[model samples]
Target: MDATMENKMGLPPPYEPAAPNPAPPPSYFGDNPPPPPGFVAPPVAPRTTVITSATTRPGSTKLGPGPTGTTCATCNKSIVTRVEYVPNNRTHIVSAALCVLAGCCCGCIVPYCMRSCKTANHYCPQCKAFVGSHQPS
Candidate 1:
């Protein structure tokens, strides 16, 4: 190159579109394809699982539990009247709540005899039981 051309602006040669580009046909790529004329979305899933406790349901096969106590797992207000256990996925959730002004009491007590679909970390080593919940206290 000549010295006059060397003293030109610092910009390099403008990029030229290369030949023999391997870009595929339009059928193989996109952000999203055009939907069919009459497309319909799929259904949503149920988040909470079924509760298999007997003390709350006795001979019932309901999904969620009854109630909670005053001394709830959240607050120590001693207001709980019954416990509520909701089976979510593979964990058995334990919730404590309170009855209204009826002065009745409620609490959740796991039978410790039966558990199902335990997570790997929550499974008991000695008894092979599933304690549910990932939080360690």
Candidate 2:
């Protein structure tokens, strides 16, 4: 019936620290580790490159819808290229959209006839070789 005995019985147990967590696997650290034993790395391959000289002939040049002056690769002559208009994807898409909206009227056909909507194909007037094509920007 002692108050000390009752207080002792009501007291909680003393604290004890729990064991520390085990070290995490190396993969979790995200550090670059050494290669495994007896691992043979493959030999590096040499890089190949192609270069065009300006003195010989200029590289690919972007052309416009109008005549462009460029050195032809086929004839190796410096001359103004003649442009020929060809209906490209942009022309077709615009035409299709116009056709859908205008009920297949002359509006859809406008893109096919317009010079702005089509791609310009450049040809060397000397050799008549296809130089390059300019897509509408």
Candidate 3:
């Protein structure tokens, strides 16, 4: 190919280096500032009790024993009670299939009304670790 044709070939342009970014400004508190008169910093809580799980269920004071005193396999800390709503097992799927096949009758909706349709899964809210699951009887 001629020199003009060579230059017109599918070749990328030359690379160019970008300019470096500027450093951030220093903080207002360079090292440590003196505390105000009669002012004292609050004491820090221990790491063990730093995280706590709050129950989301209303009017339900009872908590499952799955997380009580059980050491977390992930965070290596004491497990706390946490309730999570999870889909039911094969029962829900079978019920749904039967409902569809039965022309979605009123009686077919009974499966959806049953309380055993869903289950509760206990997990750590801190690191989102899977602790265990509980199926209602």
Tell me the spans in candidate 1 whose CA falls farther than 4 Å from its real position: 1-9, 18-35, 40-49, 54-137
C-alpha lDDT values of all predictions:
0.36, 0.83, 0.61
Q: Write candidate 1's Cα lDDT for 1-137 as tens digits.
A: 75557559664755678877788677744777878899987989969988784332211222122222212222223332332232443233432222233245343333122243222122223333322232222
In model 2, which regions exceed 4 Å deviation? 1-59
| TM-score of each model, paired residue for residue | 0.19, 0.57, 0.35
Mind sharing the TM-score for model 1?
0.19
Return the candidate ranking by TM-score, descending: 2, 3, 1
In model 3, what is the error at residue 41, expressed in angstroms?
A: 75
Q: lDDT for model 1, please.
A: 0.36
Model 3 residue pairs with clashes? none
Q: After superposition, how far is residue 66 of candidate 1 from its true place, in Å?
A: 30
- What RMSD does model 3 have? 15.8
- In the range 57-135, model 3's lDDT, one tens digit per residue, is 3223233524443555667666574756656765577576777888765546665555455566667677787666666
